[model samples]
Target: MITRDMTALRAVNGGHALLRAYDFIICGGGTAGCVVARRLAEGGKATVLLLEAGGSHHVPAIMDSTQWMWNIGTERDWDFVSEPSVGLNGRTPPMPMGRALGGGSSINGQVWARGHRNDFDSWASLTGDASSSYERVLDIYRRIENWHGRPDPRRGVGGPVDITLPESPIPLVEALIASADGQGIPSADDINTDPMEGDGGCGLPNVLVRNGVERVSMATAYLDPVAPLPNLHVLVGAEVERIGLRGSHVGSVVFRRFGQRYEVEVIREAVLSLGAINTPKVLMLSGIGDPAELASHGIPCHHALRGVGENFQDHILLGGCIWEYETPELPRNNAAEFAFFCKSDASLPTPDLMPVLEECPFASEVTARQFDLPVGPASAWTLAPGLARPKSRGRVRLRGADPALVPAIETNFLSDPDDVRALIRGVEICREIGNDLRLAGFRRREVMPGALRGGDLEMFVRNASGTYFHQSCTARMGRPDDPLAVVDPMLRVLGIEGLRVADASIMPEITSANIMAPVVVIAERAGDFIRQTHGLG
Candidate 1:
């Protein structure tokens, strides 16, 4: 039995006061961090410390499923901004990352999309690990999800994360599903299962919501259960500065809490689950990046790993093709309930475009300015077309050595002409679906980008383009021989001892849909590796 005072455990200074050293230190109590902490500490074999930069995830905005978008730009968000991209007509889109306990999972749309099977197979091919194969990853998904829908062997039961389809979907949502079927994208009972393994389909999405009202974030599902364990210590408002090194092995971790600096020794290992941006930023600050880049910031290089922050990738969504509703229907569940995945070109091997039907109006600042959009709570819908597998890649770089300074992110969205072409086709598909005869009873009028063609369509795609908030691949995993591989197949950071990265940052390629499910799988696999290595089982 574990014993720890609950009130004191959450205080900013409580963690350092409790212990100066821990068996394992997990940074960033986000999605992966929470999962890793629970898996490691639940065995009662390791003393784990989970440090989160932001406060708690108990806020209303994080708990309410309908208000998921309300968390963006709030205190819970990291509120990162990208460098101005010429691809978007010199626009610097705001990149919102969750700083709280649940990280992106706390504030995201809660869509439980397990990306296409090809996505995982690609990772298996790159890393030469059968564990990453689609069949194996599917087994992991089945083990983690506590599905609420009808019985299906493909899904699991009695797991930590509760997943369910939208109950009592609005009539407009039903019409949209019908419209998708009319447009050659057939409807399926569930999108998370077989639909993802095939060519393309549409249906109500599985959301990370429990009891139809509460949001089920990784913190709530995983961390909250094991939080009282004596072997587990959770510290909120703890901003990691950098990792201190002893020779080539991790020595200790330094972080700031309530304006006070504290250092804690790491007896076993340190895992970086700080998402893509902060993970690389932390590495560069600790002198574990490219020698030239570290020297440019006046920092001595401890480990000259060239690929600290390269290969940045994010899903780009054009927000979007809008339609006015014939009658008002308030949003339900997570607001965006229905979605479809398809290929931009028939020649493509798998589905590369994923467009979702938002219950409310959705548009980027530039797009909203360019078009006359609905205002003042008018009933409307948006078919936001997204490019799932982008050909273009971006990189994250350091602005300075100070941890307080935000890292410079170059999103480079739509930089490649192929991405622009695919998005143009995607927008066209969205328009067709929005105007399908099956949706005639619900759609009043087409609002934006009506009958546009050629340069105008391409321009629309550029102006409407923005991130889906699925930022990944900054420090990807690959075979050791791969030059750009930052972590090994087992997620161990190359050239660094007692250090591993187990978040979306390790994704070799961004998945073909929302990445929350895939990220959980990554954390699960990382936990298994850690336990197997230390004989924790």
Candidate 2:
């Protein structure tokens, strides 16, 4: 509880202390939430209150970039599960969302990527707002990044998140890169640059580690640096029960902290940054969902906003092409050192497939369960090929009216057959990239999924495919005419005042890259929007 406590100095109606009102109340202390808190409270412009349902991010596993894999599915992660899907032949995968201060950014592989330029352009076109175009969003990206590489037009310095390339110790990684080069895919100097030089390039992955060692999550980069602000209050371990809306306006939020219930007042507005899953869940629990659905849960409907928990999208990858390594080696920081982006089909405007080469045998947590995997070091490595722009869509709905229970997420992965074709192309690309002269000595033999082709390969994709941990668009911002549009171009809830969404939930569509970078840009834009509307000091 970082908020100043002056309850003993004042008493309100019925012996209660003042409701701890603030000019802005930002919910969820995750990636974007922390940035909003810092920007709003900077220079004491506005009295800000940031509430997180989780605890401090002081755990060593979370602080250490290389140890992030250990935190997944632990108390640090929300450990949510997907509903059974035919896509995986009726497998329910567990989602590793960060239940700690930094949200998914903390639990995710520390890869730092801004995605392709066309991905954000697609978002702008959907919203019909030029502000969301890649050009405008790029400025915010520049502002948020503090790249470890030398200064350039594409990179920025002295920013919150310090992003750099992590060292790769394995010989398999260089062999893979050389193989891709032999196939005519050159290196990308600055992948984040607009019209990326290597839009079709394959190389080592850039990471969000500070000094190439520690994880520089939003908690460490944004909130911790601004912790001294007198007007800023960050309440940790405070679970928000529901948002209280009074006549289409965000009134307050009811929460429980340390076994005591509290009602926090919002002087001006409330921003929801609870990621894709919880943001929609909160809206539905607060009576802002479909009227019929709300009544089924014994909750009166505040607004019949049917789009609160729909249009869910996640990155699903066909599990790796594993090969035995000649010597013992292990992944240090950010499991996957090499990454690739290329077109599955040239007809598409941008690359639709990405292959992430990891030093270890990598698979989504769920995929690891269905098949036999080698455990010993130097045994095998993987080339996990992913379908970046999937046509398949899913949904996130409330398990019940209770905010404590994890919501039911129906990923419905590979429901669209187009995804299968795209992934098949990725597999072919991986095979092409793997069969290079550089890899002749290091890779002894193909292990998992070896000697499998066509039908067998397709079956492998169905059983092993799972998320890249980029869940988004449950409460997207879009054009007014779009029924699925829960928020406007500026991220304001369609029919509600004094409420906005500034996280992955508001993304009309998920970007091609890990969502951490895009979410930061969105939150930075949101901070500007709030100040413009309410005149923050």
Which candidate number maximizes lDDT? 1
Local distance difference test values of all predictions, in order = 0.88, 0.79
lDDT of 1 by residue, 189-239 (tens): 888777798888999999887766689999999988876687888888889
What's the distance in Å from true for residue 350, model 2? 1.3
lDDT of 2 at 255: 73
User: 272, model 1: CA deviation in Å?
Assistant: 0.3
TM-score per prediction, in order, is: 0.97, 0.93
Q: Tens digits of per-residue lDDT for model 2 on 251-273? A: 88877776666777788999999
Best candidate (score: TM-score)? 1
